[model samples]
Target: MDHNISKHISGNFNQELENVRNHVLAMGGLVEQQLNSALDAVNDSNAELAKKVEHGDYKVNAMEVSIDEECTRIIAKRQPAASDLRLVVAIAKTIADLERIGDEARRIAKVALESTAKDQQGLLGNIDNMGRHVSQMLHDVLDAFARMDAEAAFRVHKEDAKVDREYEALTRQIMTYMMEDPRSIPKVMDLVWSVRSLERIGDRCQNIAEYVIYFVKGKDIRHTSQDDIERDIIGK
Candidate 1:
């Protein structure tokens, strides 16, 4: 009985909405697992683990398609209004972000598979640290979504700043490595893409946080400054 899901006269309608929300959570769980495995693949340089992560992207894509279709059917049949409509819209947007996060994880896994030289692999510093930070942000934002707590969502939104800082530091470190030895460019470039993917995943998590705020407050905060968002929404 999430307050956002209306208690309809028709019990079936209530159940349908609940089922869709549950499906979104299940998909979130799978995507989180995929990301953790991708990190392991990179840290261990296990080609087998990396290949498994790349193969798992299809499952994420399939779930996104299924959830989108279900949301469309709900809109067409239920014609929900107010909070209910917002819930459907939020779920649709959240899944799209989750799918893209999965894509970034797959991209990171590719870095492991592409490394041909041990020395080239050694050119990059430990990415697992930044990977863990983004992973926690994703987990927190999803928790905020499940509870539909706008304040909690805002807290998660703030964490993206730290991820950005980490990405910038890593980029500078990797660039220095390439400059010191231009011969490592080819392998280091793959590492660059992997770190960039990590940053993009942070952005996607922030997008989900905005969707949560939108669903609960009925306010779209996209392209808005963090200071303004707090003053306009959470500070109130």
Candidate 2:
């Protein structure tokens, strides 16, 4: 390739990378909005809000497609090597995670529709808190990814345990309620599913945090002891 043409190709690849980043952020933003709407639907028991979430999922799906196509073009044309290759793969996987997270939010909205219990009836113990915490975790993970901040990502990872504890506490309460009044089982069960969906969202946030660390540091950082990751993350 001629020198000027080589420079032009390099510019084009960088622009493509930027496009990939923008698309991922767009997907993340949609998922974030979905989470908020899901929680609102649960609190208000509004079927319309739930329906909106289900339909808005298409935007997240399309963002993933656009990002995938651009990433594929760059991979085949530029053949990003070494660190660049790793970044491409990380971006792809992160987009997948975000899309899955959106699916879980839609599921929560579905459960909201099935529920007959009012948000203020105390039928779903501590779930309001759970929704807030899990949503904040998602926000933090995406912020970490946008800034490439490994430290912030690790903080989000550590917060997952807190969300789990909250979920478990809520579960025990629901079990106690079910035992005290057998007739309440059907109505209370929907709360169980909604809270469970929030817990799953927390788990996905942890996965997103791990991916952020991977992309920022080019490290796997998966299924390892926390101490080991902290030790290596600092060194890197």
Candidate 3:
């Protein structure tokens, strides 16, 4: 219902477009699982799980390549116009963002592999909380995409601010740890990088939310203020 692909004269064309959309959702699900596992690996200091996450990055990359090819084929074969074209373009952009998010997840998992001492586990608590917040954002944005709901996408866009605040707080905490005992600087820095990855993942999720708005509303809301995004979505 969200997509108007059924309006096409050729049933095959409709099925092709539907297939592309479904593949994108499948890729999103894979990225979500990767992110959650990476966060768990960090929280539990499970090096084996972290390694699995790292190895799984190749699968995400492969999915991106495969989806990009499918989109290109659709554009060439169907010559889709208007909203159909917008849907394909948005799918392309969304997959690219999802691929980057996977890379960030891999980076976060590496932190667990490098710094898993018992003393440093205390710092992971905040990261765990922030990770959950970001994970929910990704999940919600993907749901918005599934429905082509601009309002839901805008709401997810607003959530990036909260993630930013959490990142700032975590940075301060890491700095405190470093200043209190210079000996822990190296290990603390590793945690800092993991927090940074989570922050970047939040940013990537926001980008995908923007893509959803672009597809549904036919407006590019990137680099716009939150108030402007709300007005644009609501006005439509």
Model 3 agreement with the true structure over 1-236: per-residue lDDT tens digits: 44433442245577787788899999999999999999999888889999999999999999999999999998898897887788889999999999999999999989878756676667788789999999999999999988877788888999999999999999998899889989888778889998999999999989999988887777888788888777766474
lDDT of 2 by residue, 1-236 (tens): 22322332345466667667777877898999999998888777789999999999988888888888888988998998755676688788888888888898898888668747453267543787889999999999988877767788999998989998998999998899889988888878878888888888888889888876776666888887778888888353
CA lDDT of each candidate? 0.87, 0.81, 0.87
TM-score of model 3 relative to the true fold? 0.94
| Model 1 stretches astray by more than 4 angstroms | 4-12, 116-125
Worst 10 residues of 2 by lDDT: 1-10
Give the best candidate by TM-score: 3
State the displacement of the C-alpha of residue 171, model 3, in Å, after optimal TM-score superposition: 0.5
* Alpha carbon lDDT at 113, candidate 1: 87
Q: Whole-model lDDT, candidate 1?
A: 0.87
Determine which window of 10 residues in candidate 1 has minimal summed lDDT: 3-12
Where model 2 places Cα greater than 4 Å from the true spot, the runs are 1-12, 118-120
Count the clashes in each prediction.
0, 0, 0
Query: What is the TM-score (0 to 1) of candidate 2?
Result: 0.89
Rank by TM-score, highest first. Answer: 3, 1, 2
